[model samples]
Target: MNSKTVAELLSQDVTLQDVTVKGWVRTFRANRFIALNDGSTINNIQCVVDFENFDEALLKRVTTGAAIHITGELVESQGKGQSVEIVVKTLEILGDSDPETYPIQPKKHSFEFLRENAHLRTRTNTFSAVMRLRSSLSFAIHKYFNENGFYYMHTPIVTASDAEGAGETFKVTNLDIKNPPLNEDGSVNYKEDFFGKETNLTVSGQLEAESYAMSLGKVYTFGPTFRAENSNTTRHLSEFWMIEPEVAFMDLAGNMDLAEDFMKSVLSYILDNNRDDLEFLDKRLLDEDKTKPQAERSDMSLIEKIKFVVDNNFKRVSYTEAIDILRNCKPNKKKKFKYIIEEWGADLQSEHERFLVEKHFKCPVILFDYPANIKAFYMRLNEDGKTVRAMDILFPGIGEMVGGSQREERLDVLKEKMKALDISEEELWWYLDLRKYGTAVHSGFGLGFERLVMFATGMGNIRDVIPYPRTPQNAEF
Candidate 1:
């Protein structure tokens, strides 16, 4: 079979048959072996060449990152280490990469260095694996949504609504930042802004996606989302991606089920489709301990872990129960949290979220029904008058991978909640019009795309997964 995939070529029986392969040299060993890896997979296949047949001068010109094509006969290596090998008959240099200029080498380079060379970092084994997994998971997301009859909706990137509630937004202005139009009260006049009014990059597509879900039955949006938040923490990024699915006839329970199933599906697809890449990552970059602390290990062994999670059902719990358990924990017996979590009235911080998922639940936990006062104004109010219909799916290593809620369908209730939250009603006229025209009980949740990658690949930072990360004060590409 004619295939372009390196993974496929490695596994298939091509031994003693003429085949062509092209890739950059990851490593060269023993003056007779070339460790070749294409962007196709993480694992580099060993090509054993006889120095007697090939000119040493030509081989010497080929450095670490040089692109070359090999006409070879694949052979089963009974050698001590590798399973298979390729005996190269003809080696041709397609492109020569300068050894001094190529930033990536056989030696270990810092993550910060890789960030500076974001354009070239993809050639590295770790990044190649990450990008492959990323591409596979993205396809899996579409597959899961499409198979379930969910329409893939595209949401606008430039929006007037700042839905994240983070309050940190990048202003899209045509006027000069030094001196811009201002009202008599000295506030920036938004009326004259671009789009002929106030506008900013969208933080979430949930609001826009909701409008389509109400009519389309079930719809989802997957795209680039921007946040102007100034937080420089590893978990925070200015520009990221999100996958949000809204179901018109769904409630909080249905939303939870979708989140769990969606996550499992993505994990399962990566494990199945990218098994060789993941296996190489596990052997080279992942920690030696089966249960090692999360680190930047090249051998992430993600495929095995993903399969294990897919085979198991996620644990579910309520927010109220989690609070009670945290309060009674032996470690917290004498210690009070800074923003103390009381039984149904407080917000859950990352620490609390981490403690619950990593320590108590010991697996992926879907926690729901948080108090209305701490949640966004869009959430539906519960009968108890204290909590809203919201849920957050927390995983063992990453906390709050998904956050969503059942939107308030009642016009008056929504307006009341908006008023209490001190959100300007005038800014949300179009959003209100949806309820006036034809409102249906709908639910949706925003899955932080980077968080999903981090969880799936065991990458530590939000910055690592995204190319050219746009964190506060660090937009250098």
Candidate 2:
């Protein structure tokens, strides 16, 4: 018979049925219990082998982190603290892992230690759960986009223009490190670079996705994007994946709706499929208030808090009202704020976002019409001339997971904004030509893949969600 999944094997009512399972040993308890997991779900299947029948050599080979194939009899376990278990009939040692060398022991390992040993970190319980959830979320995103008539477009990792306008792009160059090309002014010679002009890693795929969206009607680009920002916080990563969706003939409200739908679909799918893994995370990772209710103690254990986001409509607020709310607040609430949300032009900090989502609104909040001076040059300017048509989706725990805007569709207006912002109008000629040829009202959003995973899994750090995080000075794995 083919190898049965742990989930399938556990759910059956039969006892003492023949079974085969292949996985790496997670823990070996009392020289009798072998906890094995195939990197399937977070939960591991316990294989109980009698001391006499268990081969000494085989048992020795089945060290922690060793890959093993086990032939066993499935039984409804009543002994110890397990629900379902397998009684080993014959055990095969697939691969041996030296206990002395393996870093991921049964003992508790810190996140910092795990970051160092990035290659082996995936074998740990937390990382395993995160990896599974990440895979499921990726599938969920593709499924949602495909079902909703969205074409998946692959955008270039390298681009002439840095989409975010944040000036944190990692430069790509072919100049020799020892004796690099120099200009007459003693500056780095970009003309000698591979692209002729200056080129760098793309910060966002929104612009390229927008081009496809204009022609394809609806398109999304899902891939890795890099940034050289020197942020060492749990939220920032040097390299991370992004899911950017751009749609033509879509305004700000329509864009918000798409974001809401996309988030809901992905969350709902992961909550449904990865209940076991998520439940393990909830009990292990989340706060006490986030724990599942007694009535919903089994089925909906994974995503008790997320149901509110999926079921209810999000609260929408403009930048103007957000400032007023922050300014007119009582003295007690004023002291709680890290940075005072004084005016409309100020960038909304994480504190402000959290206040709106967690305290004031008590739901997900969509803040739109951000100040033009603070936003990118390509955003459509509002009539007030102070703000632009940008929007950010703020959740309870994680703030600003999705930041996007309606692109300025007029050639003249875009040019003027580019000039005012001191951006290179020559470099953006192709982008401006898009507006001149046939520009339809379009909108899109960039959902940080790590942030989404962080929100979904209740994992606090962006690094915890990504396998090998590329933070500044921390690229060991």
Candidate 3:
């Protein structure tokens, strides 16, 4: 039995006897050559067959997308690209894919069409490469946190506390949708529901992770987070994974250092281990760039940009400074931005963020100390009582890749902020207890995993990066 994947077999320096590989046939060409892949790597193993030795009926079943097991002798290839090939001795058809009915043809397909056929999209080289890179990035994230004395904590998926009140949340209830229990005010009476109180899919795990971080000293959560926003842009997803790391005794500066180091470590890992996949994606992006207008295309290739991020130090600027740069910038002055940056307390938009990262700095930028009104209530308030110890890491082409801050530790201040925001004290009693008892300066940040995948893969759409993207009004498998 050949337990080795196509990747393992192709990496050999010497030939092997009775070697077998099992995979889906990517293509069967010239009635002799077979391109087989098992999702182990981006490259396919060239399997050469002698048409005279195999029965005509058996060979007919070796169509594209067919699952097959081949027992053969691994030998040096007479081929041009690959180093080795398998000369088949015995072949068995495990499953057959009808070329007439299969959705994935051996040709270029639009990303929109691929997204609609997402279940079979991975069979394509582009998607396969993106998913493989996604898996590698996931592994690197956990590996980094684990090796750096951080505990891998699991936060609840269903919670009463909306994380930072960041956005709308999806309700989790057993009540019938048609006739939900209602209160005197006509609101859903969640008290009669399964949890006996209102609960929804968590928007962010940072708050819960913070409780653990306070105790564990350093901890991280890599899990699914949902948003109920009705956005249908290339940037937003109704459901996505988040990488959040909360640490005790860490302030804004320390938080910035941690975010930069963590991002670099993961990108460097992919560059070292997943170079082939990256190269494939890099080429894919360049080919895509050829079709776009000169201004719309990216100046740097995918791998080059990843390397640049890994090699350089992120430019850290205060919100005030960033505002100054944007207020007098060419885009704002010319009214190019749809939302103009007119004042200090105004929220920064995606256009503004991309400007700082791509045009102004020509590198990744970290903007810190945002206005208190614009930031979450948990962020530590500055002595000026205007801005918070908050920060956002901006990437080229992608705005706000990471958002986090040093949390408010003083019990009175936290309570005051919550009160001003009209958040009930009774609802977050436990969150307040953390401050009342053992509160210390702690900081954390949340990065959308899909956004990272999109950035890493140079995929234009968020839906293309995730396996089964959950967007508004689109949840088909």
Best candidate, TM-score-wise?
3
Candidate 2 — which residues are off by over 4 angstroms? 286-302, 331-333
| Best lDDT among the predictions, by candidate number | 3
Model 3 stretches astray by more than 4 angstroms: 184-186
Q: Alpha carbon lDDT of residue 358, candidate 2? A: 70
Task: Report how far residue 53 has shifted in candidate 2, in Å.
Answer: 2.4
**How do the candidates rank by lDDT, highest first?**
3, 2, 1
How many clashes (backbone N, Cα, C below 3 Å) per candidate?
A: 8, 0, 0
TM-score for all models, in order of appearance: 0.91, 0.93, 0.97
Q: Candidate 1: lDDT over CA atoms?
A: 0.80
List the global CA lDDT of all models: 0.80, 0.84, 0.92
Per-residue lDDT, model 2, residue 249, is 97
Better of 2 and 3 by TM-score: 3
262, model 1: CA deviation in Å? 1.5
The total number of steric clashes, by the backbone 3 Å criterion, in model 2 comes to 0
Clashing pairs in 1: 15-74, 281-299, 281-300, 282-301, 285-297, 285-298, 285-299, 286-299
- If both were scored by lDDT, which would come out higher, candidate 1 or candidate 2? 2
What would the C-alpha RMSD of candidate 1 be, to one decimal place?
A: 3.1
lDDT of 3 by residue, 72-112 (tens): 88988897998899998888999988988988878889899
